[model samples]
Target: MQVLTIISGVVGIATSGTEVWHGIYTLPLPVMIVALLWTGARTREFFAER
Candidate 1:
């Protein structure tokens, strides 16, 4: 899960330039958003376990 977030974040940053300059959205953006949400939910569950 951690690895997924790291990879997605990298992808997000890479594609962000195109998104900003061209004012267009791409596939990676949605992937990144899903990865981020998944990571957040996982973290929340981990803390809740305690």
Candidate 2:
């Protein structure tokens, strides 16, 4: 959970770059969305260990 936040922060910072891909500071919303989707709310507690 914490790691996901950190990853998002990093991506947000990178997305705020003025010269990102030679484009004016663009928010990496697409990447952020992807990150959020990939790491959902599922956790160890949600699974039953056999």
Candidate 3:
């Protein structure tokens, strides 16, 4: 789950950045936001387990 979240976040950021570079910036924003939130939650959980 943790690894998946991290990968998802990375992919989301990359996709968003690519889209923005092409001057298309509306669609990927929500995806990037969700990915960031998910990654943060997962990372927090992971650290709390240690």
Candidate 4:
């Protein structure tokens, strides 16, 4: 899910340090940012309704 992307991104960066390079570690950031932006408003509305 999107939440996992965010968590994994944070963990990957924190644990990997400067070894990311042009690899999987670099992937999570764009994916996480896009996912959050794509779903943010809807998620907020859903929670606000509750």
What TM-score against the true fold does each predicted structure earn?
Answer: 0.33, 0.32, 0.33, 0.39
Which RMSD values do the candidates have, in order? Answer: 6.3, 7.1, 7.5, 4.4
Off by over 4 Å in 4: 18-50
Question: In model 1, what are the clashing residue pairs, if there are any?
Answer: none
Which one wins on TM-score?
A: 4
lDDT of 1 by residue, 1-50 (tens): 54565465566667777545332234456567666776886768977855
Per-residue alpha-carbon lDDT of model 3 for 1-50, expressed as tens digits? 54555455566667776544333333356557666876876778977855
Q: Give the poorly placed runs of model 3, Cα more than 4 Å off.
A: 18-50
Badly placed stretches (over 4 Å) of model 1 are 18-50
lDDT of 2 by residue, 1-50 (tens): 54564565666667866544433133355456656666655643356376
In lDDT terms, which candidate is top? 4
Mind sharing the TM-score for model 1? 0.33
Q: What TM-score, to 2 decimals, does candidate 4 have?
A: 0.39
Better of 1 and 3 by lDDT: 1
